[model samples]
Target: MISGLIMDIMGLHRFAFHSQVGYTWVILAFVHLVFNWGKVKAYWRHRFRLHPHQDLPTPPKQLQQLEHTQKSDRRSLFFSLLAMAGGFILGRLLPTGQTVDFSSQKTDGGMFYHQWSKLGYPQALRAILNWGEQPARYKTYGDARQIELPDPKGYQGLSLESAIATRRSQRDYLNAPLSLVDLSRLLHLACGITHAPGELRAAPSAGALYPLEVYPVVHRVEGLQSGIYHYAIQQHKLELLQPGDFRAAVVTAGLGQNFLGQASVCFVISGIFQRTRWKYHERTYRYVLMEAGHMGQNLYLGATSLGLGACAIGAFLDDALNHLLGLDGQKEAALYLITVGRVETG
Candidate 1:
């Protein structure tokens, strides 16, 4: 209990230690029950009148002793109940605004959101009565410089099985510019629309509502300037949002992860939650994060297929990244990042 309290104070997780202690406690309790099995049986038989047919006459002194034992047991049970009630009240009195990361001052947002988004009777009724209107399926940049990408098909390198087998989280990268076609292929396979008719994408999205938006922070790619570009998924083109070197900015936004600056491109995946929120309601957050994971895995496999290194990064300054992509961090926010780069191979 003291160790758990210390961990809580330090903002470190105590689940592992709590789990071990819980198991040990259960084993010790079982052993205790075994050792006192005879006494337990006697108490149970007396309490339940196990032998109703047999009338066992009791001595006066023994009867007094039995009554005293029963009173003590009742008192113990009463005190245990009272202690539990006190603990519950104490938990209710504790502050709920505690921050998760001491350095960033980032509160336990996930836990807060999880509790807020629970589907109770009232929430279920609200969902049924007023399902909000859905947002547009695709995001576009009107005046941004558009770069037509090479056909994302027919230029495959490795087989599906081979790609899966060789897929790894590679952090170390070589200082080499990636081919334009390879970049195109990576973006397409990550989340591009594979089926044009229904707007189905490579990564599976809940309710066919693609809430994710992909932005590539380009470091070095052939024929493309070092800048931040948004992937126009519908047209399979790149829309250059900011055309300048962003290696330093990206490195800072990624919490000083130098690999993000060294990589050929870092794909920043954001979610416009309203797209899924209209339909999924309370569970929208869960679905949006799951979709990001699906897209990240796709990027991993795609990079592996092209014999390149790929690393999915979840640790980063959320506000800084959203600012870099011109997102407001609320209606639309960055959720995941994947860095793809050239690597030495045998």
Candidate 2:
């Protein structure tokens, strides 16, 4: 029964890859059993020689054929089973994606291996075909009233140097809602419309294509209900995309990371490559990520200046998240998320 569970655990990648390696796991399991059998026989023989006649340690001979095996095999079987149980528990309790690598190179210090993103133009095209959702009818966002602060220029860490020096990602946050003035300043500094008159908001774009969209998940902001609101750059407001913080969905979308659910606010950045891909085709994905990076850095800097806590989260269930935001994830693909709040103090 335990081995059957092990097979299932080992065969996950095989099934996902659609490869014929599932049989290999079975073979490896047997090879492991055989290696242990010899070691168990040696240990048992020594035990008998030492005492002239003594029963082997508990666990019986039913598991891994240990009636005549060496001592090491018995020990190996016990340790292996213990490890398997621990691994099974960890695997079940954690996000199904978590895993531990026991490679010597990793222990000695080496780049941790990561799965390549299944990103391809084909996948994007396939997703786009399913993008049959009605076009978003953007509406005027929250009731925003501009208010004055203690010192407009003096608020954010005095100099740009200090702000940059202290620009660190923060997860701990306060409970205070963002003031309207602070909201205006943060949005204006971070990815707000710039340069061109009545047009051209983002600082840089693939052919000024500006393929990204920012949605704010307002949880405790003042004058704003707990909801997901899209930032309308042109109109200078937050359009209610979907109501409520929806932070719980974000937690799932973020692979159940605890930080996500705890965040006071989060920005969902999506890309509509059609704004650029119409000309670049497959290569447009690269530009979209780069543009999103620019916007993300803007948020980081803006948040640092405002002295509010912020964190840029990249690992997320891309497809699942876009669906939460009512996006088909074809014309619009979720690129990244920036969660913000007050700094938590011990």
Candidate 3:
């Protein structure tokens, strides 16, 4: 049983081996049960008092020894069952390559239908119920320093086809500092609001509920302090969150990916789930993840357009990044990262 559970946890699901072990275990259990039939009968007789008028007979020395052995076996079986159950639950919770469908028709939706539509909740109701006071479009810090970004309009010069053709994940970067104009263009194209009237942004969000937030970790940006800064999309500026260089900490959070610290700037994308959860409910998670992907792609293409190298990083310690950014893992958590810098040329 222990070996079977270990194989399952390691994703080594050899059907032939598992089947053989399973059948053998079942047969052994049956045989053991048959061998203990006398003890089983005696136990039931004593427990239920089926023979109330007949006094219980004392067992002989060998029978007592057998009873003792059966008790020990029962105890071992109980612990084994517990260990198997615990291993199964742990394996299910751990990350695996296999895709598991958590959605149910009753909760997620039916064919050509979703839970949001089934609820019959209007957009106006969502605004009133989910966000009564209208959540701020931009996040602000009280005493932290701020850096106003350059105009983003002047930075859009690259053609769409050219940017798409040249887009690639770049890991090697020159030891250089990115200019403020380049940083402005990257953030604006990635997530900044394009249309202020309807609160629309460069990336398409589900139901216009922009749940994604951008944080730029400045490593070597020219004219910018080395610190963690929150990108205020609406204002098109940076709000300093923490002072001092975090290149070392970022590398640690990124699981020793030294290239992360070499970038001119690293974008940390986080999601505020409740923003979308109010309307989509159980399906909110899917939208949040999709939104993150959309923003990451935008950053990639935007960096390419600006003639800078960009790499989308997915492998990182979730808790480490959250702690580095001063975010609670539940309400707001880092979902993705993008490192951008000048491409090294020979």
Candidate 4:
């Protein structure tokens, strides 16, 4: 009664306050509850389907309440992100109302976008230069023979440190072939067998959710049949994918990058998110990228040690690549590409 009397004396309209602020809060609360209920219901349905026999409480009343709380938390986060995006877009778009005194500043400095223009990164990294002298395209597909070496120096000289130090993007190749032993060794070191004898397994996957698939593109590796091969890590052998000199098509798929053209072989890292995301839903994306990096580094180190060449490729025609690998880019989609070759030199 005292508080009511104090409010009346202040002439503060209680009905207006209640209708404005209280109504907004109640609406938000209702939406939050509804959003959470939907989320929890879907989760429960998926969970029930996955583990039908598990002795768990049915997700109706209590689960709805718990999910509503979580949804509230998530809504707050989403709104915060929306606010940031809105502010950033507004700032960028809004006109400068007035020009301030700028005599003290350097002439080169300007706004953020203008400053970006100063740091001249190549407009695009996939610019390809055609050569008049192309190595005679070896027409034969499935044949094994001793590979030809241009000079003994390319093969005889061997050191990991030197190999790494002198690495360059060399796409022009002498008409020499890559050896089978070299091919085998490269495959072993980059992506070889582990102790997983299970019918379907990959190198220690997150939640045993092995998500990566490796494919090799073969062009001029000798004593080994020329064809695309699947690295059977368990068997430590190549499962032939297709027989052809598909380098041109693969290089084109890789956005016409010259290094891919000169590469004797390449590795395509594919992912099966279901194998992982089933266990770790949202965060599985992070793990998948991390795993790709790990595999890429392995290729680099393995190539360095074997006195061969390897380069990780990020730019590629995503859809064409999927087609090149005969993949749908859905279930087991390629994540990374690595080109490997016997580095050519003077």
Highest TM-score, which number?
1
- Ranked by TM-score, top first: 1, 3, 2, 4
Candidate 2 lDDT over residue span 1-346, tens digit each: 3444433343334243433566677789889989899887876676444333346454544433434444565678789899888877865674333333434444321222221123443224333323233333232335643222221233544367867878888876666777656666666666666775546664577776677788777777776678777777666666666666587888999999877777677887888767666555445667788888888887787877777778899999988888888788886788999987767532
Residue 126 of model 3, lDDT score: 37
Tens digit of per-residue lDDT, candidate 4, span 249-285: 8889899887786787888888766666554544456
> Model 3 — TM-score against the truth?
0.63
- Per-residue lDDT over 1-346 for candidate 1, one digit per residue giving the tens place of the 0 to 100 score: 3343334333334245665776899899999999999999987677645333346787768777767776787788789898777666754575433333423555466765665566554345445446578988889998999999998898758899998988889989999999999999999999988988898999999999999999999999999999999999999999999999999999999999999999999999999999999988878999999999999999999999999999999999999999999999999999999999999887
- Model 2 residue runs over 4 Å out of place are 1-158, 344-346
Better of 1 and 4 by lDDT: 1
Model 3 per-residue lDDT tens digits across residues 1-346? 4555445533334345765877898999999989999998887565444334346565567556656766776778689899888877876675543322335443332332332223332323333333323355456675767789999876555699988988889999999899998899889989988987997999999999898999999999988899999998878889999989899999999999999999999999999887887666656777898999999999999988888999999999999999999999888999999999999543
Positional deviation of residue 219's Cα in model 4 after best superposition, in angstroms: 0.4
Q: Where does model 3 exceed 4 Å of error?
A: 1-136
lDDT of 4 at 344: 52
How many backbone clashes does every candidate have?
A: 0, 16, 0, 1
Between which residue pairs do clashes occur in model 1?
A: none
Give TM per candidate. 0.67, 0.55, 0.63, 0.51
CA deviation > 4 Å runs, candidate 1:
1-109, 115-123, 128-131
